[model samples]
Target: PQVVSARFECPSCGNIINVSQDDTSFKQPTKCGCGRKGKFRLIEKKLIDAQKLVIEEAHELLEGGAQPKKINVYLHTDLTSPLTEKRTNPGTKVLITGIIKELPIMTRSGSQSVLYDLSIVGNYIEPIEEDFTELSIEPQELKEILDLSKDPKLYEKLQLSIAPSIFGHERVKEALVLQIFGGVRKKRDDGVITRGDIHILLIGDPGSGKSQLIKRMSVVAPKARFVSGKGVTGAGITATVVRDEFTQGWALEAGALVLANRGYCMIDELDKMNKEDRDAMHEGLEQQSISISKANIQATLRCETTVLSAANPKFGRFDPYMPISDQIDLPVSLINRFDLIFAIKDLPDKERDKVMSRFILKLHQNVDSSKEVPIETGLIRKYVAYAKQKCFPVLTDEAISEIQNYYVKMRSTGVEEESKSVPISARQLEGILRLAEASARIRLAKTVTVEDARKAIDLMQYWLSELAMDKETGKIDIDKIASGITTSERQKIVGVREIIIELENKLGKVIPTDDIIKEAETRGISATKVEDSIEKLKRSGDIFEPKPGFISRL
Candidate 1:
């Protein structure tokens, strides 16, 4: 396949001639013009660069439940360079200028069949633009975008335009708006990179419009893939290696995250994913790459994808009394990766219920009663694209100080004498910075001011108060939402363990369950709390039930 030039010597006349092979196969000159029509002596052959590539349709381009199609492409000479090869890698959307030719198919009986397979002999290839940064805007549209950015209530207007049909969730809508207009990703001089993408998770009760919200987000994003957690696999979400039917060799296939690079991936029913499959997202979420090392095929594929996911609680409805980590089936490590986690509860409120009922009734009656979108969808999309393409905001001194002071103040809230629980960490600080950048981008500002910093802090404070703060201690304990265990619960478990130790010393090796519960109650731990702690300890192998109604520490 790489043969570029062939030289042959005529046996009769001893004439040396060179021929260039440009077609799919090597060709020999028919005559040497020496009057001798016999076989020529083989001289020399030169070979150049060549490679085989597999091209497939992108997952995002598929519609109406259609599957992606694939074909083999032949690359030669200039097309086989490193830069061109990288641009044509799997999962990347590319435009190829090539010749479509047919290759003879081999039948099962080992004969060449008349039927042929189509393949592309690529002469030129280029990757398609996958991010809004490459969006093209007209001069008139640019003027309109700049004018819209100057509006005093631009943020509020964008939030209102997100999903007009969904009632309430103003805060969630605001977060989604910021997510759509992402922050500026930066790389430090030391080569460390920080992501600007905001990952949002909606954990709500059944019939709370979570799926509808996800669908709306997918529709609004410039490039997005809508998938359900139940239907997705580890290979489906990341990268996998498959046997190529045409090549009869292993070929790497890009998954959802890789296919949606520089875009958004909306995953509904997030909690329905299996543990092993969910674990595969760890690298893609944090590192923005998926490393596949299966079937002797090892490669890391880029996946700079922002995830917007929705999930239902384990018990079919959210439990307001329990920590969010306890109510969901997802691992605490995985839950912590989300920048913002919102709980959408369906509570019983007389006036709110009446309004919701009326809204649904109006929809059923074919009457338009919903509030009009503050900004049209097309205009907003262009506005967002314009901002993302042209605006890259940097933090001002005042903004940096604001974020720093808030982080210091929140972390210092723990009691000085006790084992201080971390109220907020550097991760949240990074989140705050990203949100502030997004806020500034919304206004098309190149500098993040104190006002933008304040907005970010307010949103962060609201999320912390609702999801991270412990009501009993009146302090924020990240462990409550991050580890599925609160400081108060940890203290109760420690108290129960202490009671068991005391009883074991006072009584024999076996301590009665009633005595342990009575001692824990005296120490201000409720009987039910003590019993729950005991069961947890037993399951963790810290203690064991020696006999009925009796326990012994390991």
Candidate 2:
């Protein structure tokens, strides 16, 4: 075999270096020794004199058994000019048809060389297009896809294919799978489409797979885009000002939402998104369109994209007592935009620990993945494709009734105490239906069953209870924190607050916190409970400390 030397540029670092190769083929690691890896690919190559081929023509030549001897091409075009106002080089996809005349060789003192040179005889440039296909499907077909009870192994396989290397958070994985296949359109009482997409918010601590989950969905979903909230401006998300091609003046360019159109957009570090970006998302979340008149270009861009977003708690970890609005550091407007919010707190548990350990071990070592592969990754794609081609089924009476009851009970039409002020909104109800539909679609069920609705509700409830309900005050709350409270914590705080208030009225003068603690004990409240309640009241500003170790009613 003749030895040939080639340069391998690290995709991450863009460092060009040389490697020796025999004509024999081999698998190479997708990493460079400089601790950079996984986010790069072979971008460009040059060839000469034998033939100049673009990707389409190259494939055609391969089919026709015409193998050119040597080919050289240059990648020198500025890509991403169509999207960004600054004309950033996102990347390029090109096709060429020409003849190669010469080749470049290496003259080295241990130096790397560029491969292949070509003399262009003739060439053709094909327009590069973005893939924007969203899977379509009927309701009956979706139902059949989700009815996986008859084949447990198939269900497991599907999960494996979708999740692949995902570890822990089985609940999150299941929720995401449902969201992918679920239809996001809603028929209102007045017969108009209100909301047509599923909006999910994942609030978690650092390293909780929030970003990983979003990335995974981007790959599994038929059409998806992953963006970072920190990097995305308001114009980057909904629509923004750009220079017009025809008039050579500024115009509005559609953001990821408009570009994604009928697919999914996974946003990472959503809490880090600017306030203006948060404001822009509100309308798109409900109206599914962004209306703007920037640089004299008035337009409403379609943003009918299912949003899967991840955020960190404001305080870094969840504290059960604070209002969610306080804990998350996100505006109520943006928080309410999501149909469902999940708290991915890193709770320490034995089974979870074991699973995590295994997951890490598998990644650190090249263990046998043959037996671990559950479903054909390709099959999952086919299933999603099939569902997209089918029509969506309407909700049955049982499913509708279950959803209606849930909305009526948890969400009040009128405001009550701090505890009751419409826990779930009408938009959330629609989200529930979509999630149920998605679940059914995954199972290949013809129609969404009552069981599917309950499953969705169960998961939603778990999330709401932790993220929305405040255990210290028994109030519906949101916060920048990651963990919530047990019901008992609420009762304890309320009880202690009551005792402190009674002591203030009975004694007339300010009572020391210890005296209030004694009074609480006489009223059957433990010292711990008294302290907990005092802290809650203090946090809420219901009581104040006029002196050290003393309490005053606010």
Candidate 3:
């Protein structure tokens, strides 16, 4: 409803009058100057399509489990167009100028009640990127942040500041700090772009401080969103497509990831999410964008947000000898998208258990005392926001040399090119570079130094040692995490298949399980491994069981 001038003619004395429709409701001149009391003849009129929407508060603003507040707004005329409607996307912020009015509410008896509802007749609206709140830092605060960064133990202090009550996992805390101050996004002359946001996953035992870290992070970061996998859908994490009856088209609605654009998002209990819901996040995590095409509505929303997710093991506990991928139900493709994956284990140690118990008791007795951190949570939040907004570190020659040396040396560890168990790939190299840049930004430095590169490499090596090690070969293998199948597993499968073929040639199309196990054991493979390999081949349709004790290759 754009403001249009409408003219009405009076039948009495043939008088002409003009009236403007500037208000939400149309109004005609009650009585023309000619003293006419009847309906006036309409000589001109203009109508436009419009729609109403209700916007709710963002997830970062809520404290714990509070319900979000909502407000109603109306879009007029051209504002209802597809392009314009995308600006004021739900889940993001918006600044609007409008006139508020109260409308009567209907009671059970179908009559207007005394109470009324409030709505705004919007005249203008624009998109706004929210950073938790309108956090404005003064000049004095900026100086304090700079001085804090210059401390010799700056890294340790920052790590201790996050989740102070947690006993261990200093490396995980350091990684989270780096995640807050991400790397610089690069755009080349050819229009190709590289994502700077980092994604990390933590899978561990049940009571191993995973959820506690996530909750503390929600308070430590100025613009952090917290979500759980339970009760979440594909549309809830990415974007939802709704059928609009008024426009007879589909409308796009932003979800958790989009709402946290340029910020941090923590997802707890990640393993509990449905397969479809988890698949929807593959594009958002890598490309930094969310695309939805449903009912003829196709669009892409920018989601340059960093993710830190946590999950528990499928069997309720973690085993040191088991492969990380085998213990979790996530797909290999999704696993490869994460820049860093940490495995947190809870083991039994008398001394460590005693100290942890004492810490927990003290926390339960007087929580305030256990909350002591090197820096206050609020100032740390402001410091993170300032570093992300003002600092962008570029790689220096020494830093590049450090990264290159590490990659060249690591890649050379494999045996041969053809079926080599690559220890690392370009994906890991990019992750290390991003981490190095972020480490420099933590100190507000203009260029990444050699020290930053080494620190990032050390952290990456730590994670790899725990999750990416091939237990059978006693060597690091990237395929373990990247493809969920290691060189050792592949070798076992091949050996079992070859043994079956040789047995068929001698035993006439029938292979006995006892003979296969004996041959495998002679080749240094255990009976259990041989049985597992045979089961794997059977499931893959490479072989089948002809009788209870025999298996034949198909």
Question: Candidates' TM-scores?
Answer: 0.87, 0.61, 0.85
Say which candidate scores most in lDDT: 1
The parts of candidate 2 lying over 4 Å away from their true place are 1-155, 187-191, 319-326, 367-372, 409-423, 472-554
Residue 174 in model 3: lDDT: 90
Tens-digit per-residue lDDT, 47-142, candidate 1: 878788777776667899887898888888889887676676555568989999988887899788999889888988877754566556789988
Tell me the lDDT of model 1 at 99.
Answer: 96
Alpha carbon deviation, residue 480, candidate 3 (Å):
1.0
34-59: candidate 3 lDDT, tens digit per residue: 67787989888776776788877765
In model 1, which residue pairs have backbone atoms overlapping below 3 Å?
Answer: none
Alpha-carbon lDDT, every model: 0.85, 0.65, 0.84
> What ranges in model 3 sit over 4 Å off?
1-53, 57-69, 75-89, 93-99, 103-117, 122-129, 132-135, 245-248, 320-325, 416-419, 502-510, 518-524
Give the range of the ten consecutive residues with the poorest summed lDDT in model 3.
126-135
True lDDT of residue 496, candidate 3: 86
Clashes of each: 0, 58, 0
Q: Candidate 1: which stretches are off by over 4 Å?
A: 4-43, 46-66, 75-89, 92-98, 107-110, 122-129, 244-249, 320-325, 360-372, 416-419
Q: Which ten residues in a row are the worst by lDDT in model 2?
A: 84-93
Give the higher-lDDT candidate: 2 or 3.
3
Write the residue-wise lDDT of candidate 2 on 225-344 in tens digits: 788988899878887786643245775556877767677888898888888887888888778888987666778877777888899888888775555435777777677777677778
Worst ten-residue run, lDDT, model 1?
363-372
